[model samples]
Target: MQNNLPTRKIIHVDMDAFYASVAQMDNPELKGKAIAVGGAGARGVISAASYEARMFGVRSAMSGRLAIKLCPELIFVKTNFERYKEISKQIRNIFLDYTDLVEPLSLDEAYLDVTVNKIGMPSATLLAQTIRTRIYNEVGLTASAGISINKFIAKIASDYNKPNGQKTVNPEDVLQFLEELDIKKFYGVGKVTAEKMYQRGIFTGKDLKLKSLDYLNEHFGKSGYFYYQVVRGIHNSEVKPNRIRKSLAAERTFSENLSSEIFMLEKLEQIAEEVSKRLNKNKVAGKTITLKIKYSDFTLQTRSKTIPYFVSEKAIILETAKDLLYQDTLSNSVRLLGISLSNLNTDSKNTKTEEKKVINVQLKFEF
Candidate 1:
């Protein structure tokens, strides 16, 4: 039960219902209503749902028709990516004021390493509060935060008191806090994994800790070792500021399902243009082009072509997607079409793994 590990102050900040909240913030008329940000058609999917919508069992990714059935008065607002990005940049600037080690998980959430900050602040708790207050005052958004010794615990703690709240787990309490955590609450554990763990009687972190490393690996494959290490408070992953972009994509859902390739050609063209524009904005091109098709029955199929040369042009993208669309016979009527490019032109550096410098946690160390 006694071991040493380097303690780093990590804070996870998460925005509450970001897309839906932004929609509500921009439109005074949408305030205090059950709002969902996405299309309001039968084929439309909810990108985000306001807290009011959650009360009626509506959630993000639910079909618009299903959401309306759940909440009869649900309001659907179109997504505004430009507005969201603007606000997100503002929030990221606020983070840069304290520390340069900011790793954005998405436009709405990020991880900040403040073990050694610009302000030389000793209290992560106070720093988290100050950041949240500034967000509400300056950008007019509420954010929740979790402060802990590492990213794994910090991320889970942030959700404990959500919607403009913060939680701090001191170094001395890390072991006990993690041991008592539910297996499902572990950072990387999903519904399917949780069910698998339950079948093995691993209901909590403490239960998971009892299994031998060999036994865990034998059962869960590579992730079994991750579970064993994290439950014992041994996670050492850093908050990477320059996380590599794996892919860039754009997609659209049709109001009515199209049954023929001729009907889908124009939609594919528009989607390819969007993809090309995004690639140009990022100043990156890819050698691989993928065409995604979602049928009326909700099954998905992808066709990809890897060219000898990277491309970032609307004409090239459209032509490639058109070729893929007609590559095979129609399986079913298509409802959604998407285009994506991968194998981006970006540097990939191999970070050498550093052995953990374990030292016993002093009784009075900062988070």
Candidate 2:
């Protein structure tokens, strides 16, 4: 089956400790120290931690208070998104010099399809090496690269070597490499899913390969078929460059849950303002407005409404969100509030003159 498919060279490049590394590079004093980028307040979350901090068990998304507890000498630095964006652009330009097929996952990581590169490089391994070396010399930062025939294998191989290194997975070794991998290490397999798979005696890729497609579908729904193919090293998802924005959203988790409708309204207004700003900045507007609510018990609910025309104004977003909120009775005190705009008008011209196409948009929230 693998021999029948078209072979393509894919490379995944990920920056090492992106935010923390930038801080260390800018300030010579912080070069060898344990540093973190995020808020230091009681309710703050760590965005990124340096390798030194990681040694002490500090991690991103962990509470600032908990991070401090883990590493008493942890230095908290405020996030500098502007500087990160500037550095990210420099790295992206380097990728563009090789291939136009560059898909940025975030400011610090990207997947490049170098099967037909501008540099006329035949070997993906050497291309990756050149890219990494150029980035280190020009950007003063280290990046890890993974070279493989597909995105799935490439992304996984990139992490095999951390900090400043690169790894290549030849097409011939794809099957054996996957079979020896732990099921939990597969991308998109969360802790809960891993636990479920373990209970079903599926601990490794080899164990997963033994299950029939029908049996997996019966137990895991649509994702079952996805697992079936990925376990055999079959991931056809392409590295899509210039992907359009599907939605714009903003969310905030409160320090305390609120039961009062008035307080909820205030929070929703603030979130709506953020969504409106992002929509305007992107020069896009959506007809759909979604309101997401999370209760103290972790129960989540979303209410959405699609209007006749695209709207990006904060007043309209807040009004629509408030209407959705009032339609459903309060389930429980809200711990988080979010507002999102979807069904966006991607056309740059005046949308009022264009024929409106109805799109089925669904709201999905992650806690």
TM-score leader: 2
Reference-based TM-score of each model: 0.88, 0.89
- How good is model 2 by TM-score? 0.89
Residues forming the 10-long window of minimal summed lDDT in candidate 1:
347-356
Q: List CA RMSD, all candidates.
A: 3.3, 6.9
The digit string of per-residue lDDT tens for model 2 on 1-367 reads 3555556789999999999999999998999999989948886789999999999999998888899999999999999999999999999999999999999999999999888789777789999999999999999999999998789889988998998999998877889888999998898799999999999999999999999999899999999999999998888777879776788899998887899999999898899999989999989999888889989787889999999999999999999999999997988888788998888897444245645442222212110
Superposing every Cα of model 1 onto the true structure, what RMSD results? 3.3
Model 1 per-residue lDDT tens digits across residues 1-367: 2446757889999999999988888888988899999848877888999999999999988999999999999999998999999999999999999999999999999999988789988889899999999999998889999999889999999999977899998877888998899999998999999999999999988999999999999999999889888898888888888887878999988888999788799889889889999999999888899999999999999999999887999999999999999899879999899999988776352234456444433444455
Clashing pairs in 1: 4-359
